[model samples]
Target chain A: MSVLLSATRISKRFGGVQALSDVEFSIRRGEIYGLIGPNGAGKTTLFNVLTSVYAADDGRFEFDGAPLSGLKPHQVAARGIARTFQNIRLFANLTAIENVMIGRHVRTRAGVFGAMLRTRATRAEEAAIEARAAALLDYVGLAARADDLARQLPYGEQRRLEIARALATEPLLLALDEPAAGMNATETSDLRRLIERIRGDGITVLLIEHDMKLVMGLSDRVLVLDYGRRIAEGPPAQVRTDPKVIEAYLGTGATSATRAHAEPAPAGARPGAVPGAAN
Target chain B: MNRAARPRSPLAALGVILVAAALLVLPFALAQAGTAWVRITNLAILFALLALGLNIVVGFAGLLDLGYIAFYGVGAYVWAMLASPHFNLHLPFWAILPIGALAACVFGVLLGAPTLKLRGDYLAIVTLGFGEIVRIFLNNLSRPVNITNGPQGIARIDPVRIGEFDFSTTSKIAGLTFSGPIKYYYLLLVFLVVVIVLNMRLQDSRIGRAWEAIREDEIAARAMGIDTTSVKLLAFAMGASFGGIAGGMFASMQSFISPESFVLVESVMVLAMVVLGGMGNIWGVVLGAVLLTFVPEILRYTVEPLQKAAFGRTIVEPEVIRMLLFGLALVLMMLFRPSGILPSSARRREREGRQP
Candidate 1:
């Protein structure tokens, strides 16, 4: 598979703390890439750098062969990298469909005067946007509640709405930061299916999830990070069995023998135990 | 189906038509009652225009602009400079109106551009300063080179005229005697209608949607590929344009201009109209502006007479009582409705039907 996004020596610092230190990863086109790490592992920071929410201090990244350096967040979005926030950031007062329509903003080109005049072109464009937004809402199974205010939707539906909104940008690489963070079992599995379906549409997904089973079950490859550095990078099976991955997860004193006794099962299993536990 | 999917009933259509008809005949009705009433109505319409403009910045864009009257001041000064005898210039009302609006729009951009990064109260403070700065300039710019004519103000401003028909002079049209105030009433009404239509169209447009998005969440709006800085600037400029238009009309209608008319209280008063009526609802703002304007006058009629009857001499003045009641009404409305008398459709929906 061709590489869709590549980062080299990406680093960021926040005051006295190093948020990310020379992290590097490449996401292949049409692959489900999982980024799993403990809290403060710089997963969201990496996403922020990629999406140009914050500038990388050390290195650069490329999207579809073009360097993404020095671009603004909106410009990055225009380049087809869309993301969801760790905390859901829906336009709370807007309708679900309106939220999705706003996602279609980069694709549409009607300006102030055109919108004010409601010219034939603007009308046609607006109609297209509405139809597309509705389709995206339908795809996410929230079509029935298209007119409902985004904040009025259920939690799971709000997540789906965020995804629908991200998809409305017509992104090539979709980055989701803790999309399944608050979801229950059924919702997480549903999200797994949704991610797979998104890949089937030929868009690659870069997911940062704490759920081990969801990540291992869905990701074609998984990268592990600890303390702002990559500890392991391989398929789920290989990464799960890696001694260093376990050491990073369960801390320095953990061994392969105690790995089985770990509360959350081994690396690529259910996520009920701490990854960096000392026991 | 969406709740808004309900088809428009004929009754609603007829209600709209009836309201429009009443507004069209309101001046004539007031004329029969007293020309003074017509004059008040004219001022109310002008304030309505100012309120509508302020609503765009505060309501649609969610930018708290406390100094909106500065744009009005800018527009009035532009008109006074071009069309008044103070400068020995006599431009036509048509030419000066747009010039005034453009000047205000430029000022809006100038004020908005530097402060785009600030949000909420910081933005409000900067705008407040901007309004004061403009007023101070108009007040003191007469020194060295006399521009605004200092505190003495500009007078003999030209009234709107079309060829031989001057709006300041009375004319018999359709067997009806159109007085100056009555003529201005119709003129301001037309401007109000145009502004209202433009506002409605903008509220439904993509730009309007973007503004609301920015209002709801600025960071999320940026993620959605909205160039929020430019959009916010546009909101400021557009909102200021309306203020400028109203200021030009005010100059023409009053045939006088002064810095005292564009004080910080004017800005707060326009904001009160927006907040009291409903920030995002167009009709609610019109209602707020009309009520705020007429309420003072209505109090004068009732309070002055009631005071005379109750006491031998006037102890409490009408102005003080009007202000007290106005403050009390605002406080009560905020405590009860919070969203204003007619909240925007989105706010109303969220409040009424929001699921847990």
Candidate 2:
């Protein structure tokens, strides 16, 4: 019921391009927050700022009631925020389970000496790590391929493996960037179930997805960005009816025509079925 | 779990015994060359340790460290300064070895801190400079301080001695004569075993997993909550410590310390060993080290003699020809097997995907 994370006036610029400007939103705890926009909506830039992958040019973030500004990516993760890359940047040379084990690194206590000597405590911790990593693989439906190299896995499975790896971090906020980007229909459904299952476990999720169907289906609340700014934010039904979101997705010409037939729009029974909501 | 049980299997146990027997007879079998063969074997083991250490950084962590030999030099010089008569200090080997390793670890962290932001070729160039910096300091520190003895090098450094037994001297035990080089062979063998086991243990551990993760994708590793800088620094320090231990052993075994021994070429040789065998594979590194050590010697022995017998004169300098052949072999290997002769299983999988 409380806010898990919030950004205030977050802005970032890359040389000539203002990647994100005055973007702001709050994600409630135990909710799937969807971020959608046309191409280059600065959604990923916002994620980068939230995770401290990039220092925001303006503004700050608060996570779990503490300021989350200027922390390194690893430090942000250690504070219970973990993320997956949009393109599925799994540790390609590592085994499926090892990728997940790396996610548990911040939570583990073994050091170089402990690992080298394999002391009683270190051994026990390592065994626990392996057991948890295997469980995460099973959670993501890749238990049978635990020993397979990550790069060797098929594309859809690699995306799932990335999720499994992120889950291993014991994150309070799991930020997935384009998790369903390359999933087939079945995989997308599975991913939707997995995201719901994650929320069922009481963790907040920030999802950046182009698969409109999956986003509308899973997200409790939705935020729409256009060119670098937040254009709309609300429950999906309300957001889908926002003319600003419509103009951003379908451009100026379509907006005027669609606005004339506003009552005829049906508020888009399936948001994915709305012509202007393809993004 | 099965890894713990592997060495105890009957077949593996037999393989272990046969290897032990072969190693025991190795020095004597090659003793016909009047200790030169045994000396070569000792050097090979030392390089194996060096290669294994480099593997920690360049292989597992995917950080190229060309200055790795600097730590080896640090270890050797620390041992020389503490145990040799030049300093009028005679610390026991047990006391000096840890000091050597710790000193090298500190140096590794020092180098790693500044260079942590750099990756791939930039890291390589900086590390190369670091290696040269250490070597030049060793070369010039004789002035104003008279330390390192400059280019003349330090001589008569103490050999590894345990209690009443002096490893520097030849001893006859159970009718088998154990010369200095022969004793050194066993000592180096033990150290090499320790290093190899240490590497193998590290390669499968949590830190090792973090390292491989960083090597594969630094950004993703960070996103997963890995402190990339510290993990990278650990890799540098771990690699340096191994080099330090080997350096101390080298100084003690040879009873001398010299700057010429830790040049960029030596660093390149160790790096080559890691790549030649299999970057992340322990046995592959040892195999590469051994082959590189002996291959030159094999060429030295056979190439010139055959050249003279066939042509009644040498067509090219044997040294140049030796290097030319070595370079050619490496190039061919890269073309055919970019990963190395004995790649880690993960790397083997990657290679299949890459070529396919």
Candidate 3:
């Protein structure tokens, strides 16, 4: 499989502390790749770097065979990569449907005069766009709340709406930063299915998730991180049994002490035995 | 999409239409009141345009502009220099209007470019300084054998003429009839209509949505690939162009141009029109402008005459009482309807749905 996005030795530093250091990662076309790590493990920083919200200090990235260094966040988005923020950053005053419609702004060609006159072409395009927005909302179970302001939605619905908005951009690669965070069991399960459906559509997904269950269950390949470095990478079965992965999560001493307790649970065997199973 | 489809509520449409129709006939209905009433009507229409122009900046773009009248001052001074007798210049009104508008747009961009990076209240202060600087420049630049003619102001401003038709109230067209305050009033009404339509179109356009997005969330707007700097400049230029147009009409109507007319208070009055009517709403701001301009004149006549009739002398000076009442009305409106009279439905609903 061709690499859809490739990052070589990416590193980011803020003041004195390093957020991400020497991180080499690649995402292939049509796979749900998961980034799993503990809190402050630099998953979001990596996403930020990939999306060009923050420039990596020591490395570079390429998307779809084009260099992405020194690009603005919007430029990255324009180049067919879309992302959802870990904390839902939405145009809160805008309607739920309007939020999705904005995602289609890159595709809308109507100028100021055309929009003002509501020209035949503008109207046709707008109708088509609205219909697409409506369909996306339905896909995310927000059809009834299309006209409601985004901030009015329940917490879980807001997350889904963000995903819907990102999808409206018609992205080739969707980077979801902790989409299943703060969701209950039912919501997490629903998100896992949604992630699968997204990947099944032949779009590549780079997900940053704390929910080990969802990550281990849904990802085609999982990359583990410890202190801004990739500690392990493999299919869930090999990853779950990797001693480094255990050390990254449970501490070095705990890994050795719990090696007998941790090794038998094959990564692909599902997250039922793990205490902290992710979505 | 159906042009023939009647509005949803006949009674509501009838009420609105009836009021508009009555207002259309107001000049003739108040014809007996002579030129004073006509002047008041003219002033009201100009203010309405001015307010609508400012609305495009502060209301739609969420950029608090305190120097909006600087554009008006620029327009007036530009037109004065081009068409006034002081320079022995005779640019046709049509040509002068565009020049004036262009000058203001250039100045608007010059101001907007550097300050567009500033956020919120700081932008307002910078704009306020810009307005004052323009005013002081006009006041001081008259000395060395007169370029601006200084505090003397500009006189003999040639009236607006269309083709061979002179539109001056004193000059007859084709020896048949002379234009009057009513003619100027109608001309301004046409300008107001054009402005309202343009504003409505702008508000619904993609650029308009980008502005609204910036107003709501700047970071998100930028993330969506909207160029914030270019968009802000467009808002400033578009808003200033209306100020230029209104300045042209004012000069034609008064047949004179002066910097005093574009004072800071005038800027405040235009802004008051937007806030009092509802910012970001076209019709509401127009109504607010008309009310603010005309109500004071009406009160001046009624309050003094009524007091004199009852007390054999004026009980309260009309000027002071009018200001007091106007101030109180603004205060009450701000307290009661901060969103203005015809708040956008989206905004009203948002306010209503906010958590306590």
Candidate 4:
């Protein structure tokens, strides 16, 4: 498969502390690439760098072979990369459909004059945006709640709405900061199906998740990070078996070493084991 | 599919039509009541236009611009310079008004470009300082070259005229004699209508959605591919454009321009109108501007006379009472209905079915 995104030696620092260092990964076309790490392991930091929320201190990346250096967050988004926040950041006062419609900002070209004049083209584009936003809401099972304020939705539905909003950008690559961060078992499974279905739509997903079960179950490939460095990179089964990942999660000692090898081979087979089990 | 049908739509349309018709006939109906009330109405409408402009910045874009009246001053000065006898320049009203608005738009961009990065209170402080600076410049620019005529101000500004009908003078039309205030009333009404239409269209368009997105969450808006910088600057410029147009109208109607008229208090008053009316709602801001304008006038008529009769003197002045009451009303509104009288639809939805 063709590489959709490739990062090289991406490093970022916050004051004196290094948040991310020499982190490199690539997402292939139509693949679900999971990024797993311990808390403060720079997974979200890496996502931030990729999305251009923070400029990388020491490296560059490419999206669809276009260099991503010096691009602002909005510019990155205009290049067809969309992301959801680790915390829910829906336009809470706006309706679900309105929130999703904002995701079409880059696609729509109506300006102040056209809007104020209500030109024929502006009306048609607005109608098209409404239709597309409604379709995205329906895809996320939020069609009925399209007119409801986003904050009025339940927690799980809010998470789903965020995903729907990201998808409304018509992105080639979707980066979900933590899709299953606070979900219950059913919601987590639903998110898994949704992520898989997103991949089926031919959009590559780069997911940063603490829920190991969801990551292991949904990801085609997994990269593990501990303390701002990659510890393991492979398929879920191999990454799960890596002694370093277990040591990073459970900590250093004989106890963690024994638990790392004593765990059953098919533990990842269960779809919903524990919420934020690795964190 | 399950969205609630807005049953008030037809009723609201009828209400609007009725209000428009009343406004059309208001100057004529009040013709016998002296020209002062009609002039006051014109002033209120002008302030409404200004409030609408400020709403685009504070309400839609969620930018706290405490110095909005500076744009009003810019537009007024532009009109003063182009159409005033002070410089022996007498451009036509239509030609000069647009120039005034364009100048204000340029100033808006200049101010916004440097200050958009500062959010919340920092923005407010910067805008307040900008407003003060503009006033000071206008106040002092009359020195040496006598550009703005110092504190004495510019006079003999030209009135709006279409063909042979000069708005400064009364004219007989359709068998009815229209006075100066009546003529300005109609002109200002037309301008207000255009502004209202533009405001409504903007509130529902893609640009409006983008502004609202930035207001809700800047980072999320950027992540959604909105160029927040350009959009914020556009908000400032668009908002200021209305202020400029209204400023031109103010200059022409009053036949005078002075730096004293564009005080920080005027900015605060316009901001109060937007906040008291409901920030993002066009009609709400209009109601706010009108009520805020009239309420003090109404209080003057009622309270001063009562104070005179009760205390045998004007001990408790109407102006002081008006200000106190206004401040109290704002405090109460913040405590009770923080969203204002007619909250924007989004805010209304969010506040509905919630505990007080």
Docking quality (DockQ) for each candidate: 0.56, 0.59, 0.40, 0.58
TM-score of chain A of 1: 0.94
Candidate 3 lDDT by residue in tens digits, B209-278: 7777778777666666566778889889888988887887787667776678777888888888999999
Q: Candidate 2: where is the Cα deviation over 4 Å?
A: A259-279, B5-9, B346-356
Ranking by DockQ: 2, 4, 1, 3
The candidates' interface RMSDs, in order, read 3.3, 3.2, 3.7, 3.6
Error of 1 at A238 (Å): 1.4
Q: Which lDDT tens digits does candidate 2 get at residues B1-356?
A: 21452335588679999999999899999898768888999999999988999999998999999999999999999999999887888999999999999999999999999998999899999999999999999999999988889988888899999998889899999999999999989889988888877787788788898899899999999998888999999999999999999999999998988899999999999999999998888888899999999999889888888989999988888898899999999999899988889888854454334331
TM-score (2 decimals) of chain A in model 3: 0.91
Please give the CA lDDT of all the candidate structures.
Answer: 0.88, 0.87, 0.80, 0.87
TM-score each candidate. Answer: 0.95, 0.95, 0.88, 0.94
True contacts kept of each: 0.67, 0.80, 0.47, 0.84
Regarding DockQ, does 1 or 3 come out ahead?
1
DockQ of model 3, rounded to 2 decimals: 0.40
lDDT value, residue B51 of candidate 3:
89
Q: Pick the candidate with the highest lDDT.
A: 1
Candidate 4 residue lDDT tens string, B101-198: 99999999988999979999999999999999999999999878989997889999888878888999988998989999999999998999999889
- RMSD (Cα, Å) for all candidates, in order, is 3.1, 3.7, 4.7, 3.9
Q: Runs in model 1 with CA error above 4 Å? A: A258-279, B1-7, B346-356
Candidate 4, A1-279: lDDT as tens digits: 999999898888999879888988888999999998777788889988888888899988988989989999999998989999989999998989899999988988999999888888988888889899999999888888887889999999999999999998889999998888778999988888888889999999998887767888888999887778888888888887677766666555423444535432221212233323523
Worst-scoring 10-residue span by lDDT in model 1 chain A = A262-271
